[model samples]
Structure formats: C-alpha cells, structure tokens
Target: MLDANLKAQLQTYLQKVTQPFEIVASLDNSAKSTELKSLLEEIASLSDKITLKLDGKDERKPSFALNRIGENMGVVFAGIPMGHEFTSLVLALLQVGGHPSKLAQEMIEQIQGLDGRYEFETYFSLSCQNCPDVVQALNLMAVLNPNIRHVAIDGALFQEEVEQRQVMSVPMVFLNGEMFGQGRMGVEEIVARLDTGSADRAAEKMNEQAPFEVLVVGGGPAGSAAAIYSARKGIRTGVAAERFGGQVMDTLSIENFISVKETEGPKLARAMEEHVREYGVDIMNLQRASKLIPAAEQGGLHTVEFESGGKLQAKTVILATGARWREMNVPGEQEYRTKGVAYCPHCDGPLFKGKRVAVIGGGNSGVEAAIDLAGIVAEVTLIEFDTRLRADEVLQKKLNSLANVKVIKNALTTEVKGDGSKVTALVYKDRATEELHTIELEGIFVQIGLLPNSEWLKDTVALSNRGEIEIDARGATSVPGVFAAGDVTTVPYKQIIISMGDGAKASLSAFDHIIRNS
Candidate 1:
C-alpha cells in the first residue's frame, strides 16, 4: 500500500497533468479493497485532470479498455518492464503520448486529416526482444496518426487466435487487419503504405481466396526445396513470399552446407529458385500471404490468401520463412549495419581477418565465432550482457583457452560508433561498474540469438511457446494441408542442412497427401 506521503505526492503529480488522462484500473477485489480504492479517490479529487474507473469483478475483462484508450492520450503499463516485452510497452506509451515535434508538422497534419481506422497488429513471442524497434516504429506512426491503433498480441497468451490466423513467425505486422509486411520495414515505407490506403486493401483482399495442392509460403531454402520436390512429383505447387531469399540473403557464405562448402545465400537462393521455376512451380515474389483458411471439411483443400488482391488454393502448405538475427536495438546499430555491424559470423568474420572484432552474445554461436575469429583476427572481444556465458561448458572452456579472445561479462552495448559509410568502433556500458568503454573493431558480429519468422501463421498453424512453428516428424502441422520446415519450424537444430532436410521431408509428405486426395 502507498503511504500517505506517497499518496500526497501522487496527488500533486496528478494536479500537474493538464491533459485528460484516465486510470482504468483492472485490479482484482484484493487491490480494490486496499490501496486501489484509495488511489482512485486520490486521483478523482483532481476533477477533469484524471478519471479513475475501477473494475473489481473481472480484472481481465478490459477488452474495450484498449479501444477506449485508443481515443485518448497514451497508456502506461505498470510492471517489471523486463525482457523483450518492456520495449513494446515503452513504445505503446510513446504512442499514447502522441506525436512530438520530432516529426515534420506537415506530415503530422496530413496524418491527422486521415479519418479511416488503421489497426496494426504484431504477434511476437516473449523471447523476441529484437522486435522492439518494429513496435516502436508502429507506435510512432500511430501517435502521428490518431486514426491508427497499434496492438501487439503475445503469441503464448493467444495461442488459439494465432493458430487460427496462421501466424508462423514473430514480428509479423498486419495493417488494418491484413498483413502489410513481415520481418522489418522502415518508417517511410510503412507511412507510404498507410497513405496510399494499401494497408486496408490488403486485409479485404485476403478475405477471399481458394485452396491449392501445395502452398509454399516462403522463397528461401526450405520453401524452395519444398516447391521443387512437390513440383517434381507432379503436384500443383504455389510459392508466395514478400522476399525471394528470406534470411539466406543475409548470409555472406555457406561453408557448412553439404556439397556446397562456399556459396553466398543469394546464390543458393537463386539456384533453388531456378530449380523450382524449371519445374513449373507457380512463384509469386514481393507478395505476402496475409492469412490461411482451413477447409470446412476434413482433408479438404485450404485457402491461402495474399495481400496483393490475389489468392491461391492449396491442399498442403509449407512454411520455410526461416529466422532473423536478434538485433541489439541500440543507437546507431541500424545506420551501421553492413558498414561495421553484421549478424552472421560465417558471413562477415573473414572480412575482418587480421583485424580487431567484437562478438555480441555468449551463446554457442557467439563463442564459436569468437573462437573462430581468434585464429583469423588479431583480437577477438566477446561481450556477454549477462553475468555468465550461456554456451556449453566445452565451448566456454575453449573460449577461455583462446589467448586472443577476451571475455567481457555483464557488458551491454549502448551505441554503435561509425561514419556514414562504415563502422569504426562500438560503445558499451559495464553493468557492474556503471562505467562506459569503447572498443575499436573492424567488425561486430551480432550472434545474440535467432527469432523464428512465425507470427503471421499464428492463426493457421500451431506454434511452440518459443514462436517456432509446430510440426511432426513428417513436417505436418496440427492443421491438415499445412506443413512447416526450416528454422521457423519447431526443429531442434537450426542448421541450414537441417532446414533443407525438413523441407525435403515436408515436400514428400505434401506430395503424398496430394496423391491420396486425387
């Protein structure tokens, strides 16, 4: 309970609030019986400055609260605000605060004039801290445009809703109830979509579509493999993707893939795409599948709809969108991407040979990269934001034994330092000492983690609590005619070879299903 002094302090703070603000407390009877009532009374004394509403019967029945708040100032989520979710809550608050002078008034005026409702829905797992920027960007847009409403659904909390929506990836954004884009998009691009009313059109277009024999939802390795294998078996195959390569395009080299010791991700994607194309598989690029509708009858064809006013019918679907590198979301990180910052060690580690480099993350990937880079680079600095490295004991021992590798514990990356063209150094804060330091490095490998691309399919397929698409041994999902593959699926290993194997297996299963149906 808040002390009298604290309550008085809160009252003083409430008096300062010139704008209209509401405190719709969704606490249980226990809270209402105690400090909650007192707080409400204290707040009500402020008159029009703040409105206090208490719902003691049902705490969770605030379905309309979010909508009601959408019409007013920003909301403040009072909680620990820890982990990946804190960033989202912060962005939401910023949205409620409304647009500041940061954005051009001209653009703000244009946005204010828009009357249509814009709802932006993002589905993400609790582990996906990398998606904060996506939320923040949407919040900014929503603040700038009063007509826009942003909602983030926790994948774990809304499992059934996600499965029905066919969300198979995290950080999947739906504008106006239709998926506008996946992965990440810039503010400018998002604004353009909203201005042109393309966002709303996408939602309406997805509501109408038919089913196909096999619907491959990505153009990456796993998706391409599924397409090629299904087409070769003479099954009607269709592939839809927002981009051609998925995460494979981010890779600079592929040394571990069997029979291809050294190949760029783009090259591999092109080859895979070519093979699928030769097999006469229907390929759609720059197109995003907004939703998946299951057949009313068992074993019936499923409907896969796209955002581009087109739809495809499919009996089976393969999800192979893969995963994305977890970003730091610190300042200047995006501006220095490809200039000095990189995610794939195997892709960019070689470029820093004989030079200093820092690897952010203490997992197996980071340890492995540090160990690998120690042999090639003059020095390897491994910065672990946590108190201890999370990698296996053997990997940690190996990292410790490496003379060229220096481990920095409890260090958080605060900023990325670089010129407009490239990166020169990185700035970090020591958690324990509260001191800041700078490290000169030719390359910064962001091996923090990987997030599955499965938010869009949440309403269509079952996903693990971690946000990976759930699949069986044959790559079949809980929903019939919907299979999944690659890192996006709930496979134990996230290796390229494993993803390819899953794709091949899923393709075979899809083909078998098609044949039986025929």
Candidate 2:
C-alpha cells in the first residue's frame, strides 16, 4: 500500500537489517486480516533477507510472530500493526536483524542481566501516538535478550481479553500478569521498575514521606525553577509533579527559549530535569496533587495530598501546575482523536510523514505546527478563525517562506471528518461568506489555545474565570504562605523563559516570607 517514495525509503532503511528474519502471520480470512496479510507480503518482498510465512488457522483475529529463522524469541504482535504501529513493526524487524537499539548502554545491560523470564503484554490502539515508543522499547529488549519476550496487542482486536483484564486505556502495559502503567512511559523508567521488581512503585507513587520547608507542585520549567530556587535557599525543598517538562514536552521546536538556538521537546525536557537533579530537591515523579489543606490552626505548615494517598507537609507551597492543549470541540474531533487528530505534533509527526495534514488555529503554536509539518508532509493547510494570523512576525514570515504550506484565515473549523479507522478530512466555514468547505487530508492538528491545569485547586486558591490561578506581582497568591507561578497562573504571554522567571520570583518571595516571619 506504500507509495513509490515510501517504498524506496523503506528499502533504504531495511538495507541495514543484517540478519535474516521471518514473519509468521497467524491470521484468519477476515477482512482486516486479509489487508494485513497483503501489507506483510509487500514488506517481506522489499528485502531478500526477509521472509513472510502465513498460517490461516489457529488464530485470535490477526496476530503475527517475529522470529529469527533458526531461533524462537517468542516475540509476537497481536494486532494488524498499521498506522503508527507500522513504524513499530519496522523497528522491531530491524532490531531483530542486528540493528542496534537507540536505548542507552546502561538500560540494555540491565535488561540483559535480568534474572527470571519476563513476559510483557502491552495493549494499544491504532491511533495512539505513544504506543509505538513503549512497544519498540520492549521489542528491542526482547530481540536483544532471550529471557525477555513481548507481545504488543491491539486493544480493539482483542476486546474480550482487554475487558477481562480491565484494560481501560491505550498503551496499558502488563508485566508478569500485573498492570505496569496506563500512559506513555520512557524506556529508562520501565527498566528501573523491572530492576526493582516492584510494580507497586511504578512511576505513580512516592513510597515514603519526608517533610519539607518548601513544596513545588508542578514539574515543568516553572516548577523546576521554583524547586531549584527553593532548594538553593538551603531549606528542605521537595517537588511533587505529575510529569516533568510540563507543556514544554508537547512543544516541537523551541527557537525563542533564550540561548537555545533550536531543540526538540524531549531533548529540552531531559536537560531541564537534569539541571534540577543537580540540586538537593526531593522530586516525586508521577505524583499529581489532589488536595490542599492547612496543616493546623497555627497555619505554619500545609499538606499537599496526592492522588496516590501520599502526602507531604511543607511550610510554604509554589503552585506551578502547567497548562494543557485546548480542544476544538468540533464534530468528529473526539471520535478520531488518535486516528487522525493529534495534539502533540512532535510526538506523532513522523507517523504522518508524506501525508497531507491540516492544522487548526493561526496562533504561534498553530503556525509553528504548520511550519514543522510542511517539511515532512506532502502539504500543510493552516486554518485560522481570526481574520489575521496571530503568530509572531518572524514565525509568520518563516511560515510564509514555505512553498508547501497554505494559510487560510477567517475560517471556523466546524468538524473533523475521518473514516472509522483514521482521519480523512476537515470541514470549515468561511467567516466572510459563511461558505462551508472541506479539505481532504490525512491528519488534523488542533492548537487553538491552552487551558490551565488548576481545576483541582478550586476553592483553595483564587482563580480567574479561565481557571488560571491569580497571583500578585511578586507571585504571591491570595492565600498566605502560598505562592503561584508559570502558565498555571495569571501570567501574560506564556513562554518558557517567562515561566522560569516567574518561578524564580515566586521562590524568592516564599523565602522572603520565611525569613521575615522567623
């Protein structure tokens, strides 16, 4: 089904496969299986070193086993492996064919030295952007070592088992018959869990508690800065964060983040966390703050409770909970979320390479998405609701310079249109004439605005109508002994540098409060 260009690229990549590998399909004569079988045959035909074997009976929908000709590695794919999963299938093949994994040496050694036989069954949907990373990580480990084996299952195909196992989300992984996690996870994080042999401590919980003088409640750039600044004061500082790097992790290219010429999301996220790690701050990953309450009538200490029942006591608190992508709330948007609609372009852009895509919104985020996708995709259509583009002059100029990109203004995106399996098109209305138009495209990216992640802090702190926390010039909140910063606050012009500065200001404000009270 691949075009000539894609086929050529695949051949070039497959040339790196030095070892002979066999793909055994245990599929029925169903329509999905028929489609998958044809794709497999076409892929196998690309390289002389690869072979495809078909089995018509003894099946559960459409599943395949990847094995070396002379060896039984027990690696399987309990799904059709299309869409983004297509990338996973190719990477798995290359991994088996002697292509070295992108994983670090330390992680590889840990997987190699594992003691017992471990079997990982990961469930995912076709539209899940994060599924391939987890699957590829496990598959790489399995092909590299004999003791470990993995089966990446399509959740939709195996509904009966998924329901029985209570699998409710995409990329839900299980190790040795227990649930590992329910969201996107890094390879190193998973390896550390396996090393500890404790599924209970999976990136979601902080086992023990140590009181702190200052507690930072977010993990993004602002929260990191707040925690780092607080720790520098020689006070016991701790950070309780759901995930570090916050909204910055979803950002693709950060050109304006001072001193950094150009960098991707994941790279910048790692550097920000590494800088924090150099300090004495106690960081609790995967911890989301669920409640806030005064510790006692004295009001010296406050309690920050987590969703995991973990609690920490602190004399002061910094609310740096970041913001998230805003949705278009249009028709077919929710239905085709992963199928053809995506929010984090950086994470899912590669899956749409060479395809026609539409980006909703003409703001900096939307324009930047268009600029980034234009380079990889066949074409990019940017639709804005306003009459004029809202992106910075430089960004707009950069976007205008791209020949493959088209900018349409005064258009309201009314709906996202897609087939049952994936996105197919977009529907919009012209504001000037009220004329409705449809664009045939493979993907739609919604980047309208950002919503602050402060819903849980309701009734505890003052919040604006938009739900962002209200803070003073020094970043002090309405409540005493509590401060706020970042995009989560009433800060204007949400930027990484601005958030970091707000974090530093709030931290110093908190330290000043303590010093004066003492």
Candidate 3:
C-alpha cells in the first residue's frame, strides 16, 4: 500500500518543477501482482506534475524508459524501492528535482533555438574514468543545444560499432555523423563544427596537393624508423598511413625492445613520431595508400596514389606495412580486449605478475609467450586448438616444466564472460569430447598468427605466398627503387629491435639505389 504522506511529498516536489518529465513503470505482472499496480496508481494520482505510465505486459520497456529518463530529467520508482532499487529511485528524484533550476532553464532555452540535427557518438574504454566528465559535458551540450543529440557508447561493450567507426583512441567525438575531432577538445572546438561555411572552406584547403622524394608506407616501428632515417639522410621523406603505430599501438607494454627496458605502446609510438618529426619527415595522418605505380622509365621514381585524393612522387620507396593480429572470433572476446584480455604477452605480462592468466594458441609464439608469462603470472592455462604444440622441443619442455602452466590441447575458446568492465572468466569446449568448462582468470593472452598488411602492394611489388613483400637481404624489392623491411617483408623474425635494424638497413639501401640512378 502507498504511504499517503510520502505520496503527498512527491506530488509537492513535482508541482514545484516546471520542466517536462515522464515516469515509466515497467512491471512484471507475474511478480508485481495487481496490488502493487493499485498502489502505484494511487501515488501517480497524487500529482498532475508527474505522469506515471505503466506497462504490465513487458519489463524490458522500463529499461528503455530509464534510458529516456537519462536524456530528460525524470524519476522512475520501481516496486517498493528496496535496497538495490532505492538508490536508483533517490538519484532519479534528484534529477527530477533540478529540472526547474535557472541554469537548466537557460540551457533549455538555448536548446530550443537550434535548427539542425547534430548527432555525436563517442567511443571510450572502461579503463578511462575520465570519459564520464566528457560524456556529461556532451550531455549538457545536448541540453543547451536541442540540435545536438549525444550518445556515449562503451568502447568495450560495442566492438563492431567501434571497429566500424575506426576508433583507435579514446575521447573521440563524431559530429553530425562525421568524425569531428579526437582526444580532449574544449567546448568551443566542439561548437565550431556547426559552422558549415568554415567546414567547406577547410575542406577546400585540404583538397590542395603536394609531392615528396621518398614515400614510406605504414607507420609502425619499421615505417617510422625508415622515415626518420631517410629524413635524417637529407632526403625529402613522407609517410602515408591510415592510422599511426599499426599493431604495435595495441600493445600495453614493450619490454624486449632494446634500450627501452619498459615502455607502453602508445608512449613508444608518440616518441617515435616525435623523433621522426625532428628529422623533418612529413607525416600524413589518416591517409590510406590505394595504389602504387612504377615510373614508365627505367628510373627509380614511383608514383603513389592515396584514397584521400592525394598523390606523391618519390625516387625511392620503403614498404613497412606491418601485420595484423589474427582474432579468436569468440563471443565477448572482442568486448573484453584490453579489459582482462590482451594479445601481446610481452606487453602486458608484467602487469599480471602473481595473477592467474590464460594464453591461447599452440604455435612457437604462443608457447614462448606462455613460458615467459609463467615466470610472472601465478597460473597459466595454455589453450591450444591442435592436439600437439608446434613449438620447438626446448620451449615445450620449459613450458611443461613450469609448476603454474597447464596445457589444454584440442580445445577452443567458446565465450569470454565478464562484467561490463573486465573479463572475469572464459568458457572453453573440448574438440574431441564436446565438453565445456569455465576458468576464472585475471587475464587472457592471445598469441595467434599474424596477417601481413600487404594487400595494397600486390600489383606493385612481389609478395610471397605468406603475403609478405619479397625483399632481398639488403631490403631491396623486385622493383628497382622499391624496398621493404621488418615483419612486413620476407624477414623471418618480427621483433622491435629487429624492425629498427631493418629500417636502418633499408634506408641505406634505398639511398644507394637513388644515388646510383642519379
């Protein structure tokens, strides 16, 4: 039964509010019963200022209603408001209570005057708590400008959406369905996108053209290193990349890279970019190379075309397009990545010292990484899809000898289970027995194969069956002026220091080729 005094207090509070608000009560008729509905009706009748809509047929509708309430300041009170629901009800009340505040009213007035529709989709990782403030500011902007509608999507929750948007970093904002800006931006910068005339002028300026001497494709360790070396060698070097840092940016920590005992992926990438900049390398961010054409004459000149309608001519080329990590394709695996799920053991292994972890795959890299992780992590579960590991006998022996390492052969990861934030456990199925089991762990490391990013070079350069650009020991490609190095090329090992060494070697070879032709 409804308490008469409490209902009256709610009604008085609602009457004091002038802003628009609605209450949606989605109840399960099977659980709530008719008595609860009658009580709710009595509470609703107490105030004309507050409208309570009931849905006895569907409980899911209430969640949607709550989402709508989040957009507009409203209150939603669920059955009796016990421990779990009580806090939510109080928060809802607070939201509704401030509806008529002067600041809010002013914001509403500003919102009503706007004419065009502005939609913003922001992608942020659960690891970033700072995103909430940004989201709140965007929500406030939505309130102040009715034309703007902002939606904050958890980068971890929506993998496909994040990938479709090509979100590589956090705090990225999309304006009016187009990419507006990334990283932290002031409110003024966000508002400036509304100026269509300025945007058109900027677009016109972007359509202008330029050319360079040595064009380096990709921006991973190898590509950036090549750019730096070429620029330092007094060559007009330019780098074209869709996204800087390639696969290396996804790494959490890089310990094995020489000189840098411990470094995060993003930090290292920034350092590389700065280092390249010092050598006068012109970096074209967010540009994808579409085609490569060798000059008609027997000279070393090459013409490179980009999807962004930009083209450049270079006397020499260095192909350092890195490889992509092979995905597990398991449910929730994508969502939990970087949230208790990682791909590089060398990058994140130290962070999980004394914590239980799982490593997937059976190849040499998987076995080696598992062995390395076993030295740090408390427990290591090696999940291999094949019956036997393909690693060398010595590495297999080391992994098997570890007290905390357990090899689960002929198994596949079925699902990654976790809270909305981080992965807590994983479900796996045995290929032979068809039995399933769940293992609780602090993290899961994927050590699968790599897919070369050499599709764009298929017609321009000779590619091995494995998709790596075929290059000689000196990093010279089949084409006269084109060269390749590191993992993207035919070189065997893919290591940071090795990639840097290859970049150095390739730059010298490219310089020699250019000089010979001249």
| Candidate scoring better on TM-score of 2 and 3 | 2
- The sequence of per-residue lDDT tens digits that candidate 3 reaches over residues 1-518 is 54777666666655655444455555554443355456556645765555566653333322212223335421222234322223234334434534532333533454455567777766554333223334544655654554666655545444456555655455567766887765544332344345434334432433453545678888888888888888888978888776677666666557898777887665677688778888877776655778888865434468777765666678888888888888888898888776677766654454565778999988887998898888877999999999999999988988888899999999989999988777789899999999999999878888888888888878778999999999888999988888887788888988877888898888888889878887
How far off is residue 464 in model 1, in Å?
1.2
Candidate 1 residue spans exceeding 4 A from truth: 1-211, 259-264, 297-301, 307-309, 329-341, 344-357, 368-380, 385-405, 410-444, 515-518
Which candidate gets the maximum TM-score versus the true structure? Answer: 2
lDDT of 2 by residue, 384-470 (tens): 999999999999999999999999999999988876767788999999999999999988888899999998899988999999999
Error of 3 at 448 (Å): 0.3
Return the TM-score for each candidate structure: 0.51, 0.66, 0.54
Evaluate model 1: give its TM-score.
0.51
TM-score of 2: 0.66
Q: Give the range where candidate 1 is weakest over 10 consecutive residues by summed lDDT.
A: 59-68
What C-alpha root-mean-square deviation, in Å, does candidate 2 show against the real structure?
9.0
CA lDDT of every candidate: 0.68, 0.82, 0.67
- lDDT by residue (tens digit), candidate 1, 133-239: 46666666665665676655555444466556655345567777786775545353466566776455444544443445788998888888888888888767778
| Cα RMSDs, all models | 20.6, 9.0, 14.2
